[model samples]
Target: MVELSQTLLNLPVLICRLRGDVVQVETWISASGKHGHTGDWLVRDYITGETHLRATSSRYLMIDKKTRKLSFLKEAWADQIKPHVLDCHEYPIIMGDNRKLLQILDVDTADYVRTGLSPLWNDLDINQYVNYHIKYISWILEGAPRSFLESHKLSAMTVEYRKECGRESMLHNLSAVSRNGTSATNSTDHFTEDEGIEFDHSLYLQDGSEVLRARTMWMPKSI
Candidate 1:
């Protein structure tokens, strides 16, 4: 059942009905993986019953959170039968492991999260591209002001803004040592950018290289 269900996910289930934003998926449990378990699924577009997307191997799984186990149902799965979520989404949702793409490509990324704008990975100006990385950073750190960032860019920029923020997620893996000198951060964008946090970050390069640096300074008396 699980294997059969796995194939169903690979098949593009028809979006037969969409009300509000929910999408209905008409997936199937094929006849014992005849077509191709991770290979193919019989799907007809709901709008015209026209076959649009074909498939071979795909990624999908069902997990039972409470038990910390997975439920591989050979049927179907969709948060919204109507798939409405995609309609009003602010960020672009791509399938597959995007992390792998970033890793393989070795795209150089930097995060100068500060009161100043954080850099956008997509909008790498020649200077930023040339330098280890440079550009006013986009202010989309997880807790950074969301509405504030939204205000700068149109709603459409949310995805870009988020991608901009994610450009440096891998940096956390490095050690954040105690600050004894002036190589510490004090982001004007984040008034508390250095309020009391024990952190000094590194930059993630598009070339999959990291430029490590320290940020330190004497506590300023004036704002």
Candidate 2:
């Protein structure tokens, strides 16, 4: 009975810390219609009801960090688009009064994508997906932020994240086994070594129903 309500669908906003400024990027479409990367790629902006198109590409997987070269099939510009945070709340949002809302919440975009959907569930049909998406968007606009934040589900969100990670790991292992057969262990080891795919095991706890304010990347950490 868990549906993807808008309060749960994190905005599909992408941002990168470049030259000391946080810059946002729209998911791009290609001319041939066969190439692109849409991270947690939603067709419409849940908050603003703006529509976007998603495309597919294997090229994004081949991008090199040093080059940061955007694909030649990039719909508009030829400039290199580097890897960026998959989702960000810092994205530009034009309010009805033409004012800008300036909250930039940073979270693991992949984690955000997994928030609403359970690993074992299927879409059932197109209408079901659309209906759930609409409900999610509606909640984002009309739901009470204070009540949602103070709800017991807010505290349980981390547990869901852990379940998501477990599902992902299980799927990955299954894929590895299917692809490599007898060499599955070797392939998995290679994947772990090459990708540094470590799971975050830390727990998140809030003492009370008190909400915390946003904090941009103000602290320095060693790379």
Candidate 3:
């Protein structure tokens, strides 16, 4: 179980993989409590130590598999993991409450919509829920326009999970809208750009209930 799920946010620069390039990953617990703990990952070049990507995950233990209810960390387990907790210097590129951004994009008037079927495999985590990373990939494959994908590359993304689905075939109804910029929220400032485009995504089930909501930014392909 997790809150906010695992979100990957990219920096302004494009991340490229080169031959013979060695990379290093460092991860630590950024926050912990009775409910859950937040982990952060920093990926960088081994030679120059230049950061390539950053990700954060809010995870919790499941108390009941049937109900998918979360459990608080036990005293002994929390104590053992406390030694590994470390503060993070770098933060996600996309920050703050994204509820407003999700609200701003109307799925009914979405620029693109794609429908597909996704099945839950038995090999998934104990939670049996769809992985947030997979959901992002589905958004790209089903929601993004072909021309947009040809010219732009994903830069950053934020996903908020709503409901949990089990080992059944799910109707993936994904809608996407292109936006100029993000709206202002409590902690995030309003910003607009003339260049790069922002994409807001909403994924729904067959019953019209949302499975997850996400927002992503894409940069133009370099010549």
Candidate 4:
């Protein structure tokens, strides 16, 4: 029931891997594609490290609003002869877009994703579950500013940082899982008066070779 609309669907995506329920897309295509042929990777689904359904489109020239005709891919490159090669042997090439870089779902993460909560009771498709997660995560980290502040602020940073002290995990890392960026605290100074924040930060990776510490202090910048 939850279909990925335009904003999410058309936004440039990179190499995206769906492991169990964990989905991440990384896009490192040429930025110049925006003007001549903006390359995009639409990750519909993945299975066993293979792309299930994907769509890739190119931009040749601007399109006519009423006619929806292109004036670029042909106007400049003309035939150009695209190659017949797959970065990896995959399936489901449903458009004129390249089907490279699609990855399979990680079985470990897929289990979590497949069993995720569904807005519709009883059951929902994998896509639907992912949609719900996107909504839930977006709700938590609604504002990027708040996420940064709470996750990296001066006062609370030590609490998490200290927790990640030992255990041979990585090093001296703080793992304060939050939605937004800032912390839920009153202004240390006369700054914020409304709203509390959190962050989606990960634990640090330390090796004991160097002791790292940070804080929120006043520092006069040079002009």
Candidate 5:
């Protein structure tokens, strides 16, 4: 099984390209460990070499399918891959340190008030589980209010995947933590310049067990 531990997206890349435009993406393992590893991708224009976007992702490999236990890389395998691991200290950290950010996010708060149906499919990934990127897309589709979405664009997004979603349908729940610094019962209640909205999203099973949780921020669209 594969799990997406965290992700940082640079959304401005969408504005600089067009349909059928070609770009080059260079990906490398930024950090590695026995249980999981972090990867980085740099996307740039193929002709002028201008950078388009940067993305970082933390992922885990699981050995046991049922229990979802993380797999430890063998010593021999680690040795073989040592040459490919690159030191990420020089790269700009997008989501900040994963361990530190994980501590501040309140995943336990029962504030998910909005509800929607989350569909699951067999071909989401080769592992037979929902892919992390797909889950993030679903969260935006289900959680963001229509008015808020119309007026704003995602500037940066960070998601921490807590658990794997199997072939079971899920209940998507969204909680608006704030809109322009005040509590948001309705996301469109307060609109201000520069300030953005924040949300906490979760996916749960029919039995009320959470499969994924995420936090996303959106900036006001430029006039």
Candidate 6:
């Protein structure tokens, strides 16, 4: 009976029926082994199997067919999705390994999509998520107003934020040291030199051919 139920749960027909007044869509991520992060962000209209968006972070060389000249584009590309973003959001999370994972949930899709079946968001890695978060935050905080950073007793806010990020999160501790010249509380004080916190962070390039040290682990002073 259990097997039957699960089988039914995975069926297109049942999924369709349960979603009678709604759009029925499901997304899956093909798991890649622990060598590094690998996958694509793909969303399709379930019933039609029509791909709505597909994006990649890989660097690519494009050739002009007529001129036979090649140009390298180092920046990642996300086709058919950027225009849908309605707002931007960022937050921090602690993954199972106690590593700090930053989430940048870009609110994509029109307002109507929210009224219907919400567009699916899936198949993202914790590391990739953090990388994007770092990039976005670093850009937005550049030359931010001092008044904005200190508007709400930011020192206190930073202290509480670090605690929620997880006691063992390396980034959180480093951020603390940068923010206050030491950790704000006893729990995160372990991230200090006296407690021997390691600050080295390196990430593999998109094609996995090279590694680079990230420079945005620290947050804005106002944050």
Top of the candidates by lDDT:
3
- The number of clashing residue pairs in model 3 is 0
Better of 5 and 6 by lDDT: 5
lDDT of 1 by residue, 63-177 (tens): 3434424565433434322242223222211233222212111213322332222335665433232122223122112222344324322111111101122333333212232
CA lDDT of every candidate: 0.28, 0.23, 0.60, 0.27, 0.58, 0.23
Clashing pairs in 5: none
Extract clashing residue pairs from model 6.
149-222
lDDT of 4 at 134: 39
**Alpha-carbon deviation at 85 in model 1, angstroms:** 16
Q: Residue-wise lDDT of candidate 5 within 108-222, one digit each (tens)?
A: 6634455556555743577666665765565654666678778777655556656566665656565545445334457666555666666655555667666555556666676
Which segments of candidate 5 are over 4 A away from where they belong? 1-16, 32-34, 59-61, 92-95, 98-116, 120-123, 179-192
TM-score of each: 0.20, 0.17, 0.73, 0.18, 0.72, 0.17
Root-mean-square deviation per candidate = 19.6, 19.9, 5.3, 20.5, 5.2, 21.7
Candidate 6, residues 95-122: lDDT per residue as tens digits?
1221233221111311111111111123
Q: Which 10 successive residues of model 1 have the least lDDT summed?
A: 154-163
Measured with C-alpha atoms, the lDDT of residue 48 in candidate 4 is 38
| TM-score rank order | 3, 5, 1, 4, 2, 6
lDDT winner, 3 or 6: 3
Q: What is the per-residue lDDT of model 2 for residues 1-223, given as tens digits with 9 covering 90 to 100?
A: 1111111112312221235433223553222114433233334444455543221221122232234333234333224443342334422231121012222222331122112222233422332222243322222222223342232121101000111111211111000001111132663354322221111111111211111111111111211
Better of 3 and 5 by TM-score: 3
In model 2, how many backbone clashes occur? 3
lDDT value, candidate 5, whole model: 0.58
